[model samples]
Target: MSEAPALPPVRRVGQRSTLAYGFGAAAYGVKDFGFSTFLLLFYNQVLGLPAAQVGFAIMCALILDAFIDPLIGFLSDNTRSRWGRRHPWMYAAALPIAAGWLLLWNPPELSQDAMLVWVFATSVLVRTAISAYEVPSQALTPELSADYDERTRLTAYRYLFGWAGGMVTLFVTYTWLMAGPDGQPDQLNRANYAGFALFGAAAMLLAIFTSAIGTHGEIKRLPRPEIVTKPLGTHFRELWATIRNRAFLILMLAGLCYYSAQGISFALATYLYVHVWQFDTAAFGTLALSLFLGVSGAFVIAPRVANRVGKPVAAMVFMFSAAALLATPYALRLAGLFPAPGDRVMLPLLLTLFAFNTGCGVSATMLGASMMADVVEDSEAKTGRRSEGVFFSGAFFIQKCCSGLGIFAASLILHFAGFPKGAKPGTVGVEAIDRLTLYFILAYLALGWAAALIYRFFPFGRDEHAARVAALAKGEAG
Candidate 1:
């Protein structure tokens, strides 16, 4: 092959480029947040699907996720093509993702059993398609610039756009789709399918356009590995080696625990609003807005805070604080201090605690993502090959698997707690409420703290990253 040309000067990802990337990445957040928040409700209530079936379908999807995520990442890493390593796959996968997503929301007009089959099949398709896009898309962040700080900036920007997309999702559901008839249960009538179906398609298209148009000039065209000589077993063994790395293992475990908690917390919010707070469906929108503001503010400041206190310490502080703040609601509910569900007075307190919890949580999240980038450098030092995609795929595999299980677990908990499909608050036994509230606290506090503490043993700190970067730069020059 001919020698590659000298690359163009690295462009600082200014506001325009950042917004563009954010818009591209927002598809990732919208897909998850919209589906997590509404999909369960849509299936159980709107479509009259049973809780057990939904749980089974989601579990199947997750099990499939464990395999597909890593395979897609590994394939992209070794792909031999001129269009470049990730974007070729990234661009090609867009249509399938959109189509599969839309299919998930609209099952065939058939019997309930047939509907379940349709749902399960579409769930797998959409999840796989999305994994293809996201695994490669995330790889772009580190590949775009090797500078650690620039990577941080790009992640921050991407997350902010994610928050913005989530806000759009929230507004559409609250302002229109999820509007209840009258003001009480039994009078409820809302179906979010229209908004979700349309938005899913539109978001995917915007994602492709933003990424294809914006950063084309910046990414280096990495030489693809020769695949014809290497067999399938070679790829799987290499993937195993990547997973066996101590740093990668630690990151994967941490991502699993962290995202599991996040997924459950989000899934439980509907019950919290309907049962614990007694607010109308629309009121949750206000609470979601608080999340948007709080998390966005934290993303803006997380890097500076991490720089000051060190990433590990900052992560520990924020995560612990969030767990504590989140627990306050359960405590208040026990103390008889909170107003009855749906009391206007309770919204302010709920908003405040949730905002604080989400803000602190997002700060830790930014640090964790940045820390993973450092782990990539450590891996290259050990193996002498840049395998960010492989490592990141393993990391994402854990994250998605945990998230899927978390949602599945939440369903089982709700079932045991007597949160019957479309069951109203009073209809559900008090014992069930007591059980679920306790479970929420434990998932957030206990599981979350364990995930954070695992990071304390991580060896790569800020100074180490600086040193590693310098060494790599020197090696390149030589």
Candidate 2:
């Protein structure tokens, strides 16, 4: 074999660099909130589409994303560019992704079929655009810093900004846009979404570009090891090899289950908060603020938690804690211990539960992502190949696919409960609300714990990764 190309040494990535790159996840946050929080509600309640159809449409889009992501990863891994493989794709994705997102909320009035088509088409474009940026951008992480602990710290910063971005969007949508004209908080106000979409699209563009431009200078400093050129058939062989990695497979499966639960919970939360709990607009805003606080706090706490207990353990603990906490309200309600709607204790109790759950839930996500970063080192050592783009793409792919399944599960539950579209909050039957709540609780508990359990199979850890890095260093010198 030909001599391997010289690669740049791993350096201590500065705080400024992490800050800039970290904010890019803000774009992902914006996209994620749009899909998980509003897409189903907007279509089913506002436009009068069936909940199942709306959920299925988004799922179709996610399926497309699942395939497209890996393709982008493969392409970016093999790409040659002066501005660098990751940056160029990141910059190129900004406007298209933003415009695609904005257009999703602006679908013209049409037949139900036409509307479904619109949702699917727009969702595909938006997610594909996200993949172009996110896959490569995340792939850039291993290049930026090789230190295991520093990777956790960097992801912490990223998740913080990610939470901030989504919180801003939620606050604006709930407290301002959806609050409606005087005395009527109309979340069903279709016009309000136009404003939300405009702002979200603009923010997405800004976040993507800012990170891309900020990190442009560091491209030359990153290692650019020449990939071994192989026949086209070898592509399938490598992909199969990647899939067979036990650690990666475990993470992917767990993430699919966990994020699916999250997707369903997020979709159903507004319905429960406004209808079952009978919270008004201002209270909804407060709930959003509470969730934001929890997520923010968790971001600060995650790196420390990881340092103390190790990443895998920290991820499981946080993940399980979040799930158990999310099940609290429903469990209480089912057992007759929950405060009645409009009781003084109800809102405070709800807020407290939501905050803790959100904090732990987000921390779980950050820890898992950081762990995946470590997996890159392990995978390279075993396979004797660098494949950050391919690996990170799997993470994003699992997230999107599972998010689709979550929405689909929610739709099934809602349909079974006989919940009607366009039904005002507090107007649905007590039976429907009760059924929804119980299903929500069970889904969260089961899926979340299962994810945690599955994650226990990951074999790599501090000593394993350290050994891998040392071996890699020796090989490079040879």
Candidate 3:
């Protein structure tokens, strides 16, 4: 092959690009938090669907989403368009994502089975819409900033925006949308949920548009990645190559474990707070505030932490801390050292734990994502092809599978624990609550610890990334 044309000089990403790119995370927050924090609660607890059924429906959607993820990633990577690979999909997805989310929350009166069908249909639609935007958006991150620490910093800005959006949603939900209907459980009020769904969907539209258009100016300057063609054989070749890449596989597996474990915790947090600890709406809002503070602070400080200790060590430290802190409440409660359910200090203590764990968790999350970006460099070094979209899609695919299974398992556990649906706060029996706590702690510890160990084996760090970039610059790799 003729020598490749001289590559354009790569400029470091600036403040305007970082802010515009980072603003996209607000969509993630609104969509992710709404689905995670409230979907099961709304479908099963409030709307009288079985927990298992709701979980099953959503699980199916995630599975469906996982299948399409890689295809979209591949398409985006090879796409040649004026609007660029990522933004066309990003812009096209905005209105549909909002519509899908809104439809999910507005199901008409129906039998349990009918509701299950509606749930499955809408859930699939919304998740697909998300992947359409999110897979492309995430793929853009590695392209946005070439510096390792700069990527971390840009991601930190992303997390700050995302967590800010999620926090605001929680505050609004608890303060306004959580009003208990007369003769109804606080979570069961349909009107309240409509309002929450509307806000989330609306915010998603605005944020996606802002990011898609905001970043439009840079797409031409972004690498015009060499395209690959020739159908199935080429795909299989690339797939085999991806599988053989050790760093990519490790990052994929560890992310799967961590996110799956997190799914279980998020799915059940409401039950723990309301039935086990007997917290009211205001207290629930306080928990949201704690999470906001923790994640925001982590986003602010995690890049510096990684710079000092390196990304792998920083990842292990933060992830392990999160796991340990998350296990504390259950350990203390089981040991009979925790405050009684109605104790004045109980909420304060729980909020403190939440803040610490959330901070560590978000910190770990930031470093891990940056680590994956480094994998893109390693991948290019080895394969001489840039496939950020496929790599990121694989990450999302793992996350979707793990998260789906986790949600399904959580519902099964709830049923086995005999958790009451739509029950008043503080009404669940101590035995059931104990069992729920045990399940949570077991999952969190086993998965989180294993993931931490796996991350320790990750081969690429700042030095490795820098070396790879240097080779690419000298045309030793491309």
Question: Which ranges in model 3 have alpha carbons more than 4 Å from their true place?
Answer: 1-11, 181-185
lDDT of 2: 0.84
TM-score of each: 0.91, 0.96, 0.95
> What is the lDDT for 347 in model 1?
81
Best by TM-score: 2
lDDT of 2 by residue, 126-145 (tens): 88998999999988777777
What's the residue-level lDDT of 37 in candidate 3?
70
**How many times do residue backbones clash in model 1?**
5
The global C-alpha lDDT for each of the candidates, from Candidate 1 onward, is 0.71, 0.84, 0.81
Residue 261, candidate 3: Cα error in Å is: 1.2
Flag the better candidate by TM-score, 1 or 3: 3
lDDT of 2 at 19: 87
Write out the backbone clash pairs for model 2.
Answer: none
Q: What TM-score does structure 1 among the candidates reach?
A: 0.91
Q: What tens digits encode model 3's per-residue C-alpha lDDT throughout 81-127? A: 77767888898889889999999999989888899999999988887
Model 2 alpha-carbon miss at residue 68, Å: 0.5
| Clash pairs (backbone) in predicted model 1 | 277-341, 277-342, 278-341, 278-342, 279-342
